[model samples]
Target: MVNFTHQDQGTSASCWQQAGLEQIAALDPEKLFHAMASVIVLAAHPDDETLGAGGLIRMALGQGTDVHVIVCSFGEASHPDSTTHSAAQLAALRHAELAEAMDMLRAQGPRSGTLHLHCLGLDDGKLAAQQEPIRAALEQHAGERCLIASTYRGDGHPDHEILGLLAADCALAHNACHLEFPIWFWHWAQPDRQPSFRHWFRLALDASSTDAKARALEAHRSQTTPLSALPGDEVLLSEGFLQHFSRGAEIFRATWPGHRDAASAPAVFDELYGEREDPWEYRSSRYERRKQQILLACLPQERYAAVLELGCSIGVQSAELARRSTRLLAVDASATALAQARRAVAGMDHVELLQATVPRQFPQLEPGSLQLVVLSEMGYFLAADELEQVLAASAAALQAGGELVVCHWLHPIEGWPLDGEEVHRMAGQLGWERIVEHREADFLLEILRKPAGAHG
Candidate 1:
């Protein structure tokens, strides 16, 4: 998708300065040190905490707030092609570096508060499959009134996005304050083309905190400099990339308690539909018509006993699906969208329309009740874990030999963490047999069948 690497010449800090980053509202130090009982920092890799939230952690620790840094992976793959060191050796070296950096911060705090470091030893670049372990680590150290901070969701990196989503969910479950800091967002994102820039809080580092962060970043020698004069051990964080974090301020996206439910998908789509009748032009677009026909042609059978469509926006395709099913249940989150859908399929007693927020609140279905589950053009709306939950729910409802069809637009959806190809790839890993695979520049169509003898 976005072709960027640590070696690329990244956007300079001067460019960001010109973009008015200095104008973000300053984080209230009194409220942070007074209201929050503790701080829990999550890092997909070792240097993330140092890069994104080092100054904030130091300030919190100086105020006697308990601080915990949870590193999800050893980041062994960062230098995979190294000729000098093996992965195990690299892991050990990074572990020691992280500890040394923590000790440096612990001494700088001057409050004698607790500063702990945790390394989960998860594999690098594959955190999408390690959601359970990530959740367990967060639950083990999180406090009731703590602030849970992690990488920015939709940070253009899969590992960072996964950690962000998990941390947000953990914060929601435990009723903790959540903040998202950006590391890659700086290197990859142009200041103008960034994700929603609302609700950002700035922490202007004091002289002591700034010096402490500078020293801690240097402790990570393997990344700041190079491990050796070898081929693969070259410097990972280029000077230009590091400049983005070395600025004397930190920015965080704040999602407090009232904001934790994520503004509700229903409200989001309602705002879009209220502005216009068909935001996506599902009824008249030739592309939409062609995609629906292709999806209909990919079905394994001529007709189905029962069918379900996860996001039947405005019900144009729901009308087509109803024609091919004995019973059809079309679901959407927006009531406005569903009302239009209701009119599209009027007088069809077999077709039912229901409004629901999925993954967080999935509709109940009897076990082995569905003959077909059609998730056409909707899976990308969910984050990684949300998509997994939907897949699990579909698996529970589909009987043996029942089919699940996924068709999604191929391009990236703005403000979302996943794309169409990623959804299909993750769904294909559920151990079900994929009987049909079709790909086009605009979309992808996949059909997976539940295996024989597997219980619903």
Candidate 2:
């Protein structure tokens, strides 16, 4: 269990005692809620990740949990009114600062390994255009299981909110366990007032955890102005991160679906992948061939008792799989594709349609539910590391003797993980034996089997 001690900082401790506020307790070590895998922190900018859950991260890493970070935006719009630096320069500076901060966070002593950092180069506040890149990254890192941390919707900043929503989308798309931390939510947790009484759950920070958190926050020297540079007496003493431990009096609700005032999905190819006679021509045609490859990789075989396809695009392969599988779970990231899949598979009761993404909308398949898992052409468009999440969830849901199929174009794409070969090779290392390896001149196909008696 986490241990805590109130700091004898004179007035600070006294004020809290007088106001009837107690020190938050450290996280319970025995809680089943504790995840035993790597922790992935998704942030819109540099400091947000550390500020929101630095203490928790420090504790997790110190406890030997591998830490992976994915910063979606590049912080180009930060402090936009500053006259001393250009937008590009500010972005570069912030990036450098984050690099230093990451080094510091990793410097914490772990029993075995160090933290891993992945900084995706997406536009600071423009996430819509970068969806493909983000998805690609997530697909690359889809693991057996993951503990993800990100901001909440009420975190005050628009970019933060968008990141939170996107992170949730990625979580659903990948079907991983997730936890959200809300930074800059101080406005919601003010003293018990009238109708605005904010709801919050508190966790006390132990001495060691608190010290680590302070050190991590201090790593961001670029953000602290000269006046805010004092050590323990710094002006930003509260750590600037809050979390919703309990729902409390807060009313949790989701916005209605299909109420979009704007087109959220992008225009992409809608056709059977890898079926074109001129395979090379299609493969070389920018994203056209890659799209086919992703779909094909995600849907390997027509034979299975139960199959779940997440982010099924345009019913391209869904229509084909509908003919082969006894029952299929066809999911889509785009409403456009879902609508199309609905029409394409309308007469078929074998396929259950769902509009959801990973880590968040994991299809609640029963244990030993699936015979095969396919990633197809969808893995490259996510944030790379998140792909581990999808893979982990798939592993849990897959039965013994099941096969995992992956197919992706070998063509080079900028700002994504290594090509299809690299992806398969990594997958091979994750306890699955590669049973079938198909290498076409244009794409790579791999069928990996879950070793017998592996799912105990």
Candidate 3:
């Protein structure tokens, strides 16, 4: 399962700003508030509303929309290990801060309801168990065509995910339009390489709205201020994380109603890669370049006869692998990426690029037919069963003593069912003798070899 501490200083907002985050799309004010008499904003914790949708709340209220703020928890567990304060103390403080924040936001606009704050008082870290309570709390606000904004269902936090999904469910049940506001996504997600870009949008916060959000966020001083000089009492939301919310606009995602179960992964990626030559900066990023160098150094042999590279994104590393193998078959799901890979390996007859998804479209692996298989920076995209299938196929394809390298980012991604550590853990269960194991703060790499005399 994915795990992380809030203390992790994450990706700087400058990277996102540089990636053209502001240029994606603008939410039309008319369409945003059209026919919606009420707006319900659900947050997993105390300050989530201020961080993710404070500007949205202000904007909705300013347009004569009655706003209801539902906070799932007081975020008491934020500093569970604090020596200076107990969980109960933190809960009271945070609850009060939330009330103050709500009051501050309410003061920003003339047209808003008095029944604004709805604190469920659920356990902070244990929200997954209280789904019924969360749903019931939202169900109380059931009405006609209310605009509901919840935390992103895949926002990488366990509590956030549960609240997001339940809020979406409630919206659907009431036939209300819903949106997802990402609180933790900005901290861990790579710039511009996330869920379908089409669903993303931003609301431009005027000076007044931006100032209101800042002041409302400031009201949550227990989160922003350190409890004491003691250890474990440090601020949870650091400057780097807060930077994500410091912008003049807040980002939100909207999904087409009634299509909850359908996701076009290939189409999402096609849009990602088609928009740019290098979406993740694989060719230019020093972090990525260093990672490739490390993976190259982990190769167990000087060369291999036949090799397969799965999820060979833009062929930056595919071209490198081409030189080490007599024949290289690189497979990717995105045709746009495959086209870029084609250019990266131009005129290299030894290299081949194919557009193929994993498991379903995964090429059959003839037992003991290949010398090497490289599964890099992928696998986490697959469901647990699908990843296991890919691993089993790679194991069957590799000849005795053949090497298989699996590498992936270590940070928590929005929708990954598994993390980098879990990927290596599952691969370790394959019983292959690990030849090389490398772990970095941001990524994980493992090179395992099929044992000699073991039937594939």
Candidate 4:
């Protein structure tokens, strides 16, 4: 069973408060604080840094770690109805407020000149449009190894979600630890509805750090206090809302290092398919062409009654698998990739292509139904635990003497969570009798089978 902080909490507190507190108790602050030499905080707007992770910034600086903040937007549109300030004036005011907040946070630490701030100055409410520039800015400033804290992707704001994704990407690219701080998610999202993969943890703030956070939040008067008397021009951050951040601990969540499930996988293929149908040269690469031929030739049976191919990107291999199977289920996480696959296999009625994420979205097959299961060049996409789930599900679906073929690249991918060798080793430990093992300079192909007399 999946262990969630919210599920184990036995408290009379509201669901939100219990969930927040549960996450807060999960991590040891003393260890997490000293593990990093540098910290980078990515904020969608001026006040987000302070509201979401001001205490964390204070704690990091006090521990003598260098802290850098990158603000993605000036938040001019946050108060669009302000009678006292125009958008330009509002942007300038938020900029000044951010500097003041940084100053307050810096004052809590012993080191001078340790806190640095960079304002991307992108248009407010349009950071999504400037993803490339924002990503470039993050890449330029990111240190070799640092702790990156950004807004949670599920923070219910477009700018916050986009910046969070870019920050995660930059962190993964640089091999840094990435943390997500929620601003609006705490206010609106139900605890049970949060993504399962997020490893929730909390950073406890001492009195001094808490005081510094309060001062930092006070710096953003434009948000906390009302600017105009007009009924429509409301205070963006109310006292009740600010109370959530003023607690003794701040809530945070981290993504799986190097490997992400469907929820957190970088939108690489989804965006790549938008530009061109074949991004990785799936259809025309000599290397891929040979691998596909070898894969088909090594299948144990001449024809499979039922076959399932996981991560069948663009259905290049799916087209071939369709010819060998009475019915084939080809599934991939990217709908864009599946759309192209549909076109490639337009005339194949036996091949069914679906956009589904695995382990979670895996189709339920009756016991002893499927004769062949193919996991090609896709095992590295799952983490260790998810791979086990896939292995168990596949084992349960396979018929007597069924073949499970796994082919993966031997080389390690920089940001992928699992390597091909690790995936193959786990498959070997599943009590299946090894049938064929093919080793190449660049890849490894292994075929395993259930004993013919084994019960389903």
Q: Whole-model Cα lDDT per candidate?
A: 0.83, 0.57, 0.81, 0.78
| Best prediction by TM-score | 4
Candidate 2, residues 388-413, lDDT tens digits: the string is 54666677788988878787778875
TM-score of each: 0.62, 0.44, 0.59, 0.64
lDDT of 1 by residue, 1-456 (tens): 245887767778888778877787788877876888889999998888989988888888888888999999878899989989888988898999888888767744356458889899999899999999999999998878889999977577788888887888788677778888988877776765442343367888887778888888988888888889978889999888888887898888776653423324676688789998899888889998888888888887988988989989899999989999999999998999999999999999999899986764567899889999999877877655457667877878899999999998999686555789998987886678899999999899999999877644
Mark the regions of model 1 whose C-alpha exceeds 4 Å error after superposition. 107-110, 261-456
lDDT rank order: 1, 3, 4, 2
TM-score of 2: 0.44
Clash counts per candidate, in order, are: 0, 51, 0, 2
lDDT of 3 by residue, 1-456 (tens): 235567676778998888888787898867788777788899989999999999888878777788889998889888878988999999999988998888778744355544388899999979999889888878888688788899986678888878776876776567676778888878776653442333378888877778889999999998888888899899888878899999898888664343321123466588888788798999889999999999998897889899999989989999999999999999988888888889899999988888887754678657888999998878777655456667877877888889989999998865445677787887887888888988888998999889987645
If the candidates were sorted by their TM-score against the true structure, best first, what order would they fall in?
Answer: 4, 1, 3, 2
Model 4 residue 372 lDDT score: 94
Clashing pairs in 3: none
Candidate 4 on 288-307: residue-level lDDT in tens?
A: 99988999998878899899
Q: Candidate 3, residue 379: CA error in Å?
A: 19
Off by over 4 Å in 3: 108-115, 192-198, 256-456
Q: Quote the lDDT for 13 in model 3.
A: 90
lDDT, residue 426, model 1: 79
Question: Candidate 3, which ten residues in sequence have the lowest lDDT sum?
Answer: 256-265
